[model samples]
Target: MMKIEGTLYPWRFRLVLALLALMVAAIAIRIVDLHVFDHDFLQGQGDARSVRHISIHAHRGLITDRNGEPLAVSTPVTTLWGNPKELQGARAQWAALAKALNQDPKVLTERLEQQAGREFTYLARGLTPEEGQAVLDLKIPGVYGLEEFRRFYPAGEVTAHVIGFTDIDDRGREGVELAFDEWLAGVPGRRQVLKDRRGRLIKDVQVVQNAKAGKALALSIDLRLQYLAHRELRNAITEFGAKAGSLVLLDVKTGEILAMVNQPTYNPNNKRNLEPAAMRNRALIDVFEPGSTMKPLSMSAALETGRWKPEDRVEVAPGTLRIGRYTIRDVSRTEGGVLDLTGILIKSSNVGMSKVAFDIGGESIYSMMQRLGIGQDTGLGFPGERVGNLPNHREWHKAETATLSYGYGLSTTAVQLAHAYATLANDGRSVPLVMTRQDNVPEGAQVISEKVAKTIQGMLQQVVEAPGGVFRAKVPGYHVAGKSGTARKTSVGSKGYKEKSYRSLFAGFGPSSNPRIAMAVVIDEPTNGAYYGGLVSAPVFGKVMAGALRLMNVAPDNLPPPEETKAAVAGESSKPGKGDRT
Candidate 1:
């Protein structure tokens, strides 16, 4: 019986040993297949969980004035983002995360819940490097930080209208920014990185694509002139208690925009409560009836027809002319009766201008305005620029034509008016207005002959020199030539004009004999007692031009008399210069 039991135990041991060998062999084969045959597939799945391809933001271009003064720039910043799924059940760090982000715990929780299905969501944007580092140091799972850029304007509201602003995503929205977005925006690249379970970047694997920086943009603006214009325009707005204003200064020879500014401007850096009105580049986008400012153009047209002369008389007797039901009169009822073309301009008579425009005929006047860049774009490459309305010759009734001549029926922008004045300064050669610096200024279209332009310019000079001219536009030792306009504001959503609400405007240039700069200033809704262009807008032009001429070292064109010079040197009282009105 013992021998039989021993034999059975040996058989059982052999069967168990065979089973153990088979199990070992099967386990070894499985390990080999996973490590060698399916290695790529398993590694891919692991990488899919731990690795990511992230955007490597390209640095936006630098915007600078002609003198290399920085305007719009891109500064380094960090953006914190996270994957809600990775952050799921990360309740322990939620409070700390909320604290670091300056967010309420409940809000953070709700946001996470809302974004639960999203792979990426921004927790904070445009954070300082130190702040982002502190958040990353919290070691919260699913939290991450990416290096990015934020647009910054060093000049702030001073250059708001010209330089414009970008969105949080670093995209241009208006002004030069929107006009040259493609040129100013850079192309982004990509990078592969290893991230931990908490979504923290563990290692930078490789650059998927090299990022290229946007090309730097150099504008034609002179920072010195821009600052001067801004200060003067702001002062004018404040002094006049105006609702808003716009000013533009151009280089006569180059047709380059030397300075442009808008009032009620917003700071691009902090635009959480920005208004649409404040963001508009008024000089280029907003159009207003140029009022008496358009008188010079009318005079130019009449002169071009060979039917009118500087000495030609227009009997504005009673200082008013009836065109149908509308009566055109001078501000002073009897101030401009029986005046020549020169006198008409000097006195800024609506009656005289209406008659003159009527005599010239609407077709001729429209053609002249078109040639001078009125009712047309200045080609400054500005966004949302409106081509001013010019009624077709066939469409003009006698009254409509008269009103258009005096700048009531038609409209023009500050830039367009400036460009037209610049054309006069350029001896009637209509040049293209440009915002960016150009290597060579193109040949301008000949609108009026040099003789006509010179004659008109001289006549305009009398507008500042004559007794009834714009005396407030005077600049010491400079023969300034300009026109002032005080037009009733057209009521919005209605056809009639607003009573007592005026749009004051001034368009002119300095050194009347040898013009170097052409400028236009417009003040909207001056609530102060003085609302005339000569009283409100011309002073801004004077102040800005005085500084601009001195800064540019423009030679004094109108030297004072010996007595006056001596008196000025001695700080003594002296009589005004010739053509100066008391």
Candidate 2:
């Protein structure tokens, strides 16, 4: 029985060895099949878990003032992101991660739960590198930090409306930022990287696309003048308790905007709770009736028609003129309302202007306003600029034309008004307004005859330098020319005008003998009981223009008799005489 059992065991052992050998051979064949025939498919599956293409945010452009002072710039930051799929199994560490992120664990967990099927989600954005590093220090699975850029404004709210602000993605949203967004926004890039099972970056595989930084932008703004204007305008706004305001200053020779500021501004750096009203660039985007401020220019139109002379007298008797049902009054009546053209301007007499408008007809006034860039595109390249209204009547009547005389029928913007005054400053030559610094100023068009423009400019000086004029706009030691306006604001939906609400305004240029700078100021709804342009807006213009003239070292044409003699003596003494030229 023992011999038989041993023989059976040997047979059984042979059969088991054959079965084991066959199994090893089948496994080897399958291994070769996977290694060669199905290699690409299997490799792709492995790569899907560990490889990623991440977006590389672009570095936005730098914005600077004409003097190379930094205004808008980009600073390096880090963004923390997570893979919801990878984070599914990372719940145990979510509390530690939430603590590092300064977020509630429950909130973080719930967010992850909601996006459990997603591959990526932002944990935090625009954090400092150090702050993001702290969150990464926890070594939590599925969490990562990425480099990014955040837009920063050095001037902050002081330069808010002009420079505008960028969105979180470093994209421009308004003002020059939006106007030249394509020039300022750089192209984004992509990168291929390898990560571990826990979503930790193992290595940078390759650059899918290299990021190109945006170009630098140099604006026409003079930072010194900008600060000065901002300070004065802000003080006036706060003093008068005004709702909003704008101040625009331009180079008379170049049509370059030197300093433009608006009140009720916001810090571009801090973008929370932003008010839409505060962001409007009132100088260009907002329009008003312009009120009596248009009198000087409109009178220029009357002169251009050759129907009225600077000394021509209009019988504005009874201190008012009745045109149809509208009764235009000279609230500032003098000598029973009989005034020459110059007197009309100095007194800002609506009755006189209405008579002039009636006599000259609306055709000439509308044509002149259009040439002044009113009711037409300023071509300033500003975003959201509204072309103010000027109706083109098929038949011009005395009553209809009267509206243009007092700045009631048409509307204009601060920028447009400044441009018109600048045209006078430039001897009737009008150039397109520009935001960027210019090496070669564009050729100006002769919108009005130089003689007529000079005559109007001379008369306007009396509106500021003459006795009983708008004296608040006077800059001592400098001859100034300006016009003031206090217009009743048109109610919402164009439902007539509001009796209590007034828009104060002033448009002028300094060194009237040879004007170099032109400015326009507008104060909306001054509530401290002083709503007139002479009281509220002229002071800002005077202060800002004085500082600007000094900053630019413009020669004063209105120095005292003694100072002028002294300056002349100094100039003669400094001269090298005839031999110096050779």
Per-candidate clashes come to: 2, 0
For lDDT, the strongest prediction is: 2
Candidate 2 lowest-lDDT run of ten: 1-10
Q: Per-prediction TM-score, please?
A: 0.88, 0.88
Tens digit of per-residue lDDT, candidate 1, span 1-582: 356754768988788889999999999998898799978878889999998888889988899999899999899998999989888868789999999999999999999998988878999999989999999999887888889999889999899889888888988888788889999889999899998865667899999998889999999999989989988888888988999999999998889999999998999888989898998888888888888898899889899889988998888888767766777778755443588899888888888888888777877778888888888867666788888787775666778778778787788899999999999988999888888887897797887999899999999899998887788899998999999999899889998989899999999998887899999999999998999999899888888888999998999988878998787866644445744676
| Model 2 clash tally, residue pairs | 0
The residue-level lDDT of candidate 2 at 156 comes to 90
lDDT of 1 at 281: 88
- The local distance difference test score of each candidate is 0.88, 0.89
- TM-score of candidate 1 relative to the true fold: 0.88
